[model samples]
Target: MMGDTGRRRRSGPRQAAWEFFGAELKNRREEADLTQAELGMRVFVSGGYIGQFEQAIRKPQLDVAQRLDHILQTDGFFERMWRKLIKDSPYADYFAAAAELEALATQICEFAPTVVPGLLQTAPYARAVTIATNPLAADEYVEEKVAARLERAHILKDATRPVYWAILHEGVLRLPVGGRATMAEQLDHIAALMRTRTVLVQVLPNEEGAHAALGGMMTLMEFEDAPPTAYAEALLSGNLLDDPALVKRVQATYDLIRAAALSPEASLALVESAAEDYRRCASTT
Candidate 1:
């Protein structure tokens, strides 16, 4: 058996739910006499993925959970657990609250001053950044974070995913977060995302100096079914702002920041250039 580590054993209400979820899934699957591989085939995911679910290292998509509930004859048990898992905070309370809102947002406008936005981060880049922030973090904790961050990207595949708009500071392009190779891959991923037309990224040039959101980062989420919300972050802590006035203020500042940043086409050019620069550095070193 694997030792407790990473987000699997991370403490929080959400962590407990995930533990229970794994136990319940394991019991139900075994009672049905289905091996992990057998269950994976029925769910159309890999056996390894099923194992992750059983270990509570990763949570399944809602559709996946529903299908599992069906296959295991759990009668909506998985579905209910899935809901609780998503609604609960996976990170800090405020950060997780914003994440939950992001899942349902119709439009996600983000302003990142220091680094690449989490949703836009590649696996290596995300892992490196997480480790850098918490140098003492256990390897398992880091792996769990990488899993969670990558999982956020899955939202992009959803047909109903919100329009993703991000403005990145120029420093983000210059700083080599995970050294040359990782940063190269990171920039390549962002450039590719821009070409895909699902995301719009604008770069705030160093020449442009400071903008409306200079000291911190902000994510503004607009929802068709509910009131809009905003989140601000610095370091490990963040806040989810539900006040109408505060949300509006942040939205307006974002608009100003966007206006000051380079156009999407131009930003893509810079991103591509930065990627090549990293690749070049990697080759020489």
Candidate 2:
């Protein structure tokens, strides 16, 4: 019965379940005499974003769901739904635990030797990565994943201040994804964020070969009141390491990687020039 009957309506998620969830959110907020804007203010998302949550156009991460539950006094309804939602996502199985921590992280340090880190990915770049990684997935399913991947960055933009420090290998700049235009745009976006102090990016030059972090990507996240954890991911498998020893080793490796990387200023210059080169090539093509 809730299927699209008009141009404005968009179909997404498990229809009946999301409807139940969204309805309860609206009802509870109304019961508390709070507008969507007011609820969003408390929830640390935008008013329009709250509307999207109602329509299930976006899915909330576990921590965001908890925040919403606390703000709306929904008795863990959103958190319950978030659990189910995570079980149904198309991403690597082990990444969900890490994603939850990322939402609450006060600081994030990442070393990406192969590709752009997920949080800094643009829409086109993310879609390209997903399609390449999931070659057999249905179009609709892939779109769902792409949308979710983009949503992960919302935490960094929200009221909770998280310092993001990224160490990217020089190869990440040369290896083009989604073609030259998209890669160029992606680099420009990173530069813009750096200029605004939204993120700190350093590039590890190619000549720094045979380093401690030779392969794979890792992210170290820190919370205000919790011990830090590290996440490392391969093509289809990932691990969340919480043991203080393993995480400490990873953290030390990352520190060395940062030391080997170009300074932030030099990294920004390289990124800008590489982007310009890509843009030029794309224009010619």
Candidate 3:
């Protein structure tokens, strides 16, 4: 397995192109005598979001790009640029937008009922999950996926990283993902991060019964300048919600789930205990 050096590089020709796109957008908007907010209003996105696009911190979807092209009278230049850059995304089409926003968020809260969130997954655990989902996937594809996931995790290591919080269900700890040894390492990693005060974690016990956000996984993110957004994922597809009412409701559901979860200290104990159990099983085998 590759260490930090093996992390997928997000720079190169594509990075240069993204920067150019941002610069061109900014120049065109100025030439048109339009403020960022005015341009965003014509394109049906928030002014902050437009600024993010201009700064290359976030990517725009195809529809949004088309809108931008129309507003700027660029004769589909933005759309063409978007098409070329989009083909390089490692994430699924449904999740690419949310992933982009993740790097720009100031705070992130996740409710994970089945598996650990991607931002917290170790390489082994991430590889195991990827291969399980695509049993016939080629080795190159698996490695690419694992590398992409690890790259995403690197955001947590950044000095300006968001305040991250996660609530995991009891079953997430009990499930022996990647076998005992891998699970042991995974839990230990989480515990270690908690000890360093890098992240806050809580666990919802099985006895808690059903909850408002139990049926699916929810990720809520708050940005420094942009409006808040929420993402929900299921078997294959995911939805990113930006509407004020919808985001507020998702936030409320997350708050409810958090209230029902064990305290952070107790959750650490449970996670450490689970790691010990796996260590023993791994040793025996």
Candidate 4:
């Protein structure tokens, strides 16, 4: 287990608050004379999950926090604290939990049918997407979101963890998000990461008609000590799924989509070619 100082150093001030929550949970659980597994069983989560929560390696959802209040007889203290902590999060309510899990994942596989995945987005592209969805949002709000998205990308710099794999539809390359120059820069960044072996990407070309996961974006995350989970997002809502049966189904769909994508080598060439075309177009403009 990492010390509080180490966790705070890596995750910053927000992490200190979560660490406080974890420490309190640990103290209360011990007072109740409950083993971590016993507490988890009562709360309907795994023992390992309870351990993660206590370590501040994962944050609990509202419902789980409420359950903790009930099981531990904390008089709603956990629930109230949870609401306060989540309210301060920069990510969308639907995405905050998933974003936390992304840091702890051992492997992440994403399928993007429209725009580039947030982890792969450049600042310009992220800003464009933010504005596209919230055209009336204040500039400060937009910049905050772009900064948060870019911060998530830093996980890739770790060099020794969370093997990232992404499959982007061909349309994602040609979307001209933020304009030709921005799209060119985005593609170039992805190509550079591919060349450095920082991430693996495959393109699901337009020619591969009617592929699986055509509905929206899906991410499957594998953890070192916990069961794998799947996340699917559409429009305004997102769902994180941990049920073994549901995760298995999500995994199967991802496998099918991966099968339909171009080989990594071919995909890199396609991405580079697309970037060149955008650069050419931008030069003319």
RMSD of each: 13.2, 11.0, 4.8, 2.3
Per-model TM-score versus the true fold: 0.69, 0.70, 0.87, 0.92
Show model 3 residue runs off by greater than 4 Å: 1-15, 30-33, 212-215
Q: Report the lDDT tens digits of candidate 2 across residue range 102-201.
A: 7657789998888999899999999899999889989997888888888888766854457999998999999999999999999999999899889999
lDDT of each: 0.80, 0.79, 0.86, 0.89
User: Using TM-score as the measure, which candidate wins?
Assistant: 4
When 2 and 3 are scored with lDDT, the better candidate is 3
Residues 1-285, candidate 3, lDDT per residue (tens digit)? 212321233355765787799999999999999999998889888887788778776677788899988888999999988876766779887887788778667789999999999999999999999999999999999999999999989878976678999999999999999999999999999999999999999999988758734558899998765678899999888998887999999988888889999999999999999999999999999
Candidate 3 structure, TM-score to reference = 0.87
TM-score ranking, high to low? 4, 3, 2, 1
Tens digit of per-residue lDDT, candidate 1, span 133-162: 889999998988888888888777665566
lDDT of 3 at 187: 99
User: Tens digit of lDDT per residue, candidate 4, span 4-115?
Assistant: 4234334767777887999999999999999999999999988888888888877888888999999999999999998887778899989988887887787899999999
User: Which residue segments of model 2 deviate by more than 4 Å?
Assistant: 1-85, 212-215
TM-score of 1: 0.69
Q: CA shift at 14, candidate 3, in angstroms?
A: 4.6
> Which should have the higher lDDT, number 1 or number 4?
4
- The clash number for model 2 is 0
Higher-TM-score candidate of 1 and 4: 4
> What TM-score number comes out for model 2?
0.70
Error in Å for residue 156 of model 1:
1.0
